[model samples]
Target: MTDEGELIAGRYRLLSRIGRGGMGVVWHARDERLDREVAVKELLLDTGDSAQAAEQAMRRATREGRVAARLRHPHAIMVHDVVEHAGKPCLIMEFLPSKSLATVLAERGPLPAGEVARIGEQVASALAAAHAEGIVHRDVKPGNVLLADDGTAKIADFGISRAVGEATVTGAGLIAGTPAYLSPEVAAGGEASPASDVFSLGATLYAAVEGAPPFGDDENPIALLRRVASGELVAPRRAGPLTDVLLRLLAGEAGERPTMVRAREALTAVSEGRPVELPPPRRPTLLSPAPRVRRRTVVVGIGTAALLIAGVLIGVLISSPGEPSAEGDQPPVIGSTSERPDSGCVARYAVTNSWPGGYQGEVIVRNDGEERLTGWVVRWKLPAGHTVDEVWNGSLSRAGSTVTVRSADWNSVVRVGDSVSFGFLGAVEAGEGAVPELVCLPD
Candidate 1:
């Protein structure tokens, strides 16, 4: 390995080494052509009898670079280029001045609940996007997550990531991901799925909250694999809803595990202060609560007596035909006719409100269901005869028959039973009713 200030590929000037792993070294470098700093990963080529191994490593590096380059997401690190330097492969990625989650934990112990949730949600979203594109992260330990200076979570290190349907590259039959975060299926030599990512994410969250991986101490990869495969690890307590979520993700059977989308929803709910009900624990048969008996006879007697008394009262108080009815006994049922304008149509964070200028509407958002809302997207039509003229607190985008406002990234995650206020201005036409419909998307 070379020291800082060494030039690679004749153009990328190495500033300093940022990270090192089993496969290669990651360096902070300045790309002369782009006039910006970037991270360059360089693999060490093998010699002697391991020449075949070197060839395989080069191929894997090339493939990873290609795959990562194709994934474009706000939370994914961007791959710029891949090249060969000194007979070894190198990949250039977006340079970010951020600390790894592992570093943060080491420095500050556990993080606050809100901050952990925020980070977890971002990582989950990124995973969802990647999984939708047929990519499996394969490795999702805390070290792979980058906490950018701007507070954005950037997922990195796709060195071992594989696309769905791709042939397995870990031909040695050895496990791929860090043992602490390995999904049971992966530990047992099965193919990784979106679920595997979810499992690893759960392990990562466990570490974030409990300050240690759930598997604890058995650093030998094989031993860790056995423990994961057996599903014998205890969950972190007092971790709130996170504990439930991690347990589901770490289920021994892949089929029993929750989907990444579902996991995200659960985490979002926790972040938003919504209650996440875990399945009731099984109890001893002898200790079960006894059922209550029904009181049918007493109920029937009360109903019969009330009906007979009402019949006699009606016969005595009946008025003659055409006689005036007492206003006190019979009052007209009139429906309310007052039309009140809605004034709650404004967008919160992560949502954009595109109502026309001068248009106003009301939005009543409730954590109606038990689940928490990590984020939401609302689209509504301007009331007939009224056109939206202005909006606030969110960005707005409009198309024919609909105006969509997305919540701001910061406010996208909302808690259960919590409500947000948003309003917009629209030109009011005579007799035009403006009602806005809101759709909440859970994290």
Candidate 2:
């Protein structure tokens, strides 16, 4: 309600209203005492809420500003002070002549991969720095990203951010971030982690390259929230080179999302004109095609009538599971025993479920090699006491005591130091046996 030229806290004079968002309005203002330009953000308070709740909300906002002040990154906006104006808290921050990423996208549509990556590198680095100090910018979206004239991309608006242990300002069941950018976990009422921020950044960059959020732009907030909570991401067609990294950051599993540090490195690689080596898409099935399949079979063409039947039957049996081969589906072939020392892939299996009659298992295969891996087949004995009943993510076959699980089309390639996970459900004789050892074969 304050008019232009009005002074707040007896120091800063309001010049004009520059921006308004759901939570607050930003003003082009002047620091009368320091004789400098500044931006003042007026925090909106709920008059209907009890006086106690309102007071708590004001303190929380001031505390968030103080936390943001601790950060001094080139890509992070600087928070100067917190003061009272119109009987409410107004946070004073640095004023920059720039446009929000949202406005830019509205005017220019999607950005180029290189430009998006450059912007992402700066913003991701800023996030990593803030995370290092135990702060989270709960709200990270195009609207909060500022593109300065000097080409600096800065992350603004920590109004809803809370220190790791602090309570949320949105109260129970209320999310603090834009629904379009919220991670699935947060949409499902899960706590926000560094990974959460990475998810948001992924969504933000996704919008940068695709011209809209991964989830469709539905006018209904609840519908959009449902889409985010569903964790079904629309792939980026125009992202081009940025497609891989953006998907990695938007992985459905929080643990699967790339770390901000790793994200920053990948983005930097793109910005520097180097190739970005990202791990597989968050959901492997969506992007990767199934590995090329090979099935070797034979049939007897001619022989004595009875002999022909026996020979043809042999072929069928030989090609079937539980038959032994000279080197039946062996581990990746090693040229020499000495070459084994150079193998860097590792596989681990865990029994996630079990019953007296059967159990379920999951295996993760990882590449620790210095170079990227192409395709792999993992071998493990089904254990003398167990029999595989069903499998997912792979083609499974048994030859005598050994079981081979070939990578599905999608998981054939493994990123350096990253991994692929697959699983199976199988029967157990006495429900007791030591797990089997796993060996990965290169394609």
Candidate 3:
């Protein structure tokens, strides 16, 4: 019921309501003392919670607000203060005159690939900064992205959504983001992390370039959630050069998704039309288990197909054989593998991700023997000018074009029906064979 001209805390006067979101109402206000314009967000807490829970939520919201104020970035809205007014937490932020990305997309339809990539790069840079400070913008979507009059894109509502999430309960549950842009893990009722923010950003950019969400936007929140939870996404036809980067951001497993820093790098590369070169994985374990698939029982018990659809949607489709992905769509596994047999063992090699002069690949070694294997070696010959620069989860040696990978002591034993994997980063001359036949031998 706060109207124009109402003074909150005796220092800031509300001029007009500028925007509204899932967490609260935002107002265009004037700082009476500072003599400047500011945006004030009044967060709405769920009254259904116990008095104690609500108070705890208030405290956490205040703390998060303070932390948000400490973050400074060009593409992020700055938090000026967190004040208690009328028993609600209100965040004072920098006011920039502009329309939301959502409004622009609604009016203009899908934008050009280059335009979207540039915008994504700015927003991703801001999110990267926030993440470095340990802040996860749980709600990232086109609506939260402001297209300023000066053509700068700044992300709003950093810590506020998380604060409201402490106590706000929607009819659909306590989800924090718009159903269409949520990561599969968040839609599946897990905690939001930096990776979730990356997925959400990917969905946002996907909508910007494709004119629709990866998962079609269903009217029923339940149905959308179900689609999101299923993590099935329609392929992007118009993403053009942005296809690979978007796919990386939308990876179903959080760990599989790149960090915000890397996301920024990828977006930057796309904006400039160059292949992105990623650093070697800090610690590459056995290819992370295929993305999490919510059990059918869990899905059915949650609600009707209509209700479950309210969840989030995401997927890069990293599935194993016979496992149907979200929405009953069966997308192929990412890379093709070549297998070669040698001396009681087998090695399968697949190039996971590649760039202009370099590529990443993995080799899975299986004993295929009745007895367990104490150790194994995988060998492959790189096409003339190609070379492996780094290897993980195994030891590496090379003689001329022949590359030999021996298992690390910790992962040396391969039990019956079990397999061990090693990954590498290699540089390849243009036009050389991408996937090489791998040979395995018992050590």
Candidate 4:
């Protein structure tokens, strides 16, 4: 076996091992012939597997390179070459200075809604390209999502992929994919399709924002699989404006989930702090229809369950007595205040992250008036018990619920039509109205 500090194909020299998965080992290697760096994946075949199984595994490894090479997108991993080494297949891929989504979530808890939306958009776009090529990525999990240092998110791991109409590689009645991210139909031995990929994508992004899989992280794989198949998702309390889109994506039925293209569009809107709307399914999957379900007294999907569980979840999370929210759960609040007289600047307040009794809100100040200002300020009023926990991109000086923010040194100047945004983490007692009419003023 080739270990560290070895040469593969007499062309690529392995420097160090970077990652390992069930099917292969990835190494940080250099293409000596080309005088650049690249990642090399060595297929790991099971000796105990049947001859046919071993052959299929090798073919799958080669196919990964072929499939990825056909895709040319900023958010998709690039496949450089596929070569033979030690009588086995080695797939050469672009070396990205990045960490997996799983690593990010593990180091830091759930991400802010805006960041999650951006990640979801990039991954969804990559998936859309793969689906257009008739490729089905059976495995879509946080561990397979690479978040580049340059703020790009891309999908990885096509070892388990199969083109549409292709026979199963894992054999009949055998399931492939991580249990926590599998679609309901895939958990039931159904074929992997575009819809299934979308479902898996949604599950990954859900985990990104919720801090856990919707079904809860069951230690046992069997238990996790059962939860996914049964559509037992815990309602999200901290999703903020992403709740609607997240719920629609986590729908139990594959046909019910938005298409990858549609999901990408919706995620882009969310990331840009625009009005987020999920488009309905484009067309039902002809190859694999959604699993049929008989109606029951209680709805089995996330859509209805979210509405039913909102009140109870809110009450449990925000226990302090305060003014009741207008909607049962916290409905999305997106509004911009009128221009202030002094600086003629307008500020828009949008909540990016949230928790029970608390949230992370961003305010974007726009210069809508005549002359350019060197600096600007804004002020707002929160509920009686509400307080600012932290401020970013600006300086915060507050007197109880009345808070004022001054422009940061870096973003001091604002020309006409130019905007700069700042955010804060704040908490209010349950049932309290923390909405603020942020009015910009002279610095």
Candidate 5:
């Protein structure tokens, strides 16, 4: 029987159980050979199954070790070694004095927007690096995010993370992630992708700020799965500037969501209270400085090219002049300011997402002028009868027909050639959703 003070692998002495999850039990232990503290995870296996099944489980555990050991990031827990003890695989990892985000939320309730964004930024950075290595963190949740004693946040438990094309360790037809944070596609029997990880990250951050999961914390797992599979996520109430980032991350279609890298940038921008500018496209060679839009333009576009390279086709259209598309697949680019060589700043507006009676809009304020701005306000007239419902990443005010968005305190300064952005959801009448022009003033 396994008990405290028992020695494993002839060098590690088991102390006490520090954590328990679906996969295994994590014990705080001492590495007698190295004279250091470490975490030992005793992998649980089904022994009653056939010998072949047992062997496959063992192989899977070994493969997990190999896969996790390849990742080396400051925010990711390090896997030191893997060994077999009592006919099961045990993972030895770096031990840190920390509390899981799950425990923190349970004890502190909802976290502040800035604090949650900081946490999300760090965790997303690790996940982004992991994805670049072709590893997918299939189970990303609050329980897997660790808050270290030195105020650093690290992502733990990559045991369930799968490399591309690997067979699932779980039994046939079984899902691998927590229902509350599972992406809609995964909840509906689809494969987990980096996009799914973005969804799970969004759900984790959503829970951190809203005091509950996006789909609510239902008691029954099956019922929760049903709700998640339906893909109707509840809107966040307390997100404030964090709301738009969460919305983009929690997009229903996996392809609609941003990449983990872009998610990390967005979270970082929000945490700093600046306009959110997505990182530039990866393949600069495939894009033209001025490309004409048609019925279907197939070229390298922001947020679209990376997903294409990953084998997922996304319909992010940039419409030509005039009315928005009736399909409403992607909000059309309404208008932009004329570019001047040394202009201080310029504003461009696009309808990001739209529906029957509402739409989401984004404004990119780019610094093109010689002087840096300590503060800024962008103003434009909303179409007659249209009203702004909410805004994120900036403060909103109105004077009759004119709508003004001022930079937030944390994001007020504009550097040369850099950009900041804000998004808003608005109520609008059909055919009257277009804005005439935007004027930017730097303070």
Candidate 6:
């Protein structure tokens, strides 16, 4: 454990221990350079490791640092730096002054559907971004998610994430992720993928609504892994349609599970109080008989260019002419606008961090526009192929292809600079894609 006044990397002044995990201790610190609060994770080295293990550990740390640095998303915890502390690896990350989902649920009970959906969307978005970059977050569980003071959900701890095509540095005997959220493939030592992350998201969502993990008990890790491998976990009906989505995600066969995009759509429907229909199963082509190829017949013909010109002239006369243009000309109007006083108000939104599982983020709606806004609505377009899974902080309604979030009575009023924040969960399409569009409205 680090002393209260101890400083790491000569830049971060440790304030106090915020958390402790199997790998190390997490301290809340002040970044003297950025003048912002940050979290520093310090790992303590075990004395018995041989030279080979030490080299492997260093390699793993280097790989993790690279992966974490490459991942950039609103839901992902930003890594500021990685350095050696006490001869072991330590990572500096964005400091979140809020509690984890597990602690919040323990104290506040089950969260509402809207909150769950919003959190799920943000985490899924983050995962999509990481997966697009070929990084698989090996660990996705409730404890990894932090609900920030600004009501944003940020995923933390990339210590075990593996970049695609990279050599596996963690030993074979050790399990990398929490047993309760592990996919069957992961339990069997198979490579993790975006699909695996979706499975973990399902488990995390199940726990969020049910107030406990699907397969958790007082039993040991081995027993939990056995249950997960056997596919004997129960769905959390209390989570509503979220349970159905989880069932699909937790399917023993990865091919049978819905893609993150599809899952997000289902959850979005649930959040909007609409019925969700599962997509048709993709048929296996190999199981069907192959079609016979057919030979094409060739035709020999001759045409006269002079005759074609006459036919074209006759066709043009038979077609209707274009519509007439309008007669009047209108003048453009310009007006001076003043910013609302409530523009400075901060809107708060929350994302529940469940690493490797889901992506979530929150948007704060401030009355920056020149208006006393009430009963406001916000609309935004996700990336073309991306989809929203859940939403919270108000009534979320979707029209056509756009998502519209409206403030409820308790959250509706925003006077001159007053702000209100809302959150959403989405499954970002994994690949090299542009960031989704964001827009807001008042009144």
The sequence of per-residue lDDT tens digits that candidate 4 reaches over residues 41-60 is: 87654434466645555565
Would you estimate the TM-scores of all the predictions?
0.57, 0.62, 0.62, 0.59, 0.60, 0.58
171-265: candidate 2 lDDT, tens digit per residue: 32222334678776565433467888999999999888888777756654444544665567766788888878888888876767778899999
Stretches off by above 4 angstroms in model 6 are 44-52, 159-177, 218-220, 280-443
Instruction: Evaluate residue 112 in candidate 1 and report its C-alpha lDDT on the 0 to 100 scale.
Output: 68
How accurate locally, in lDDT, is each candidate?
0.58, 0.68, 0.71, 0.67, 0.70, 0.58
Please tell me which predicted candidate would have the highest lDDT against the true structure.
3
Task: Give per-residue CA lDDT, model 3, range 189-239, as digits (tens).
Answer: 445789889999999999899887777666555555545655667777889
Error of 2 at 14 (Å): 0.9
* Model 4 stretches astray by more than 4 angstroms: 49-53, 159-177, 279-443
Native-referenced Cα lDDT, model 4: 0.67
RMSD of each: 26.1, 18.8, 16.3, 22.1, 17.2, 22.9
Q: Name the lDDT value of residue 147 in candidate 2.
A: 99
Model 1 has an lDDT value of 0.58
Error of 3 at 122 (Å): 0.6
Off by over 4 Å in 3: 48-53, 166-177, 278-443
lDDT of 6 by residue, 1-443 (tens): 45998878788899999888656689999998889999888754342457665555556666677778888888899887777766677788887788888778778877876678777777777777777787777677787777876768877776343311121212322222345676754543334667777778877877788666666542344445445544556645566656566667666545567777777777777677788797532421111212222211111111211110000111111001131222211111111111223433223222222112234445556664466676676665555655666664567777666887888665677777555555555554553333334445454
lDDT of 6 at 196: 73
lDDT of 3: 0.71
* Residues 1-443, model 1: lDDT tens digits: 48788777778999999887644689999998779999998854443356665566566667767877888888878888778776678888899999998878778987766677778888888888888878788778888889977788877865344321122212332212345676654543334578778878878887788776666545343344446544556546546656666677666555566777777777788789888654422320111222222111111122122111100111111111233434222222211110111221222221111112222233323343465566555666645665555443345777765776665554555575555433343455554443344333433
Number of clashes found in candidate 1: 34
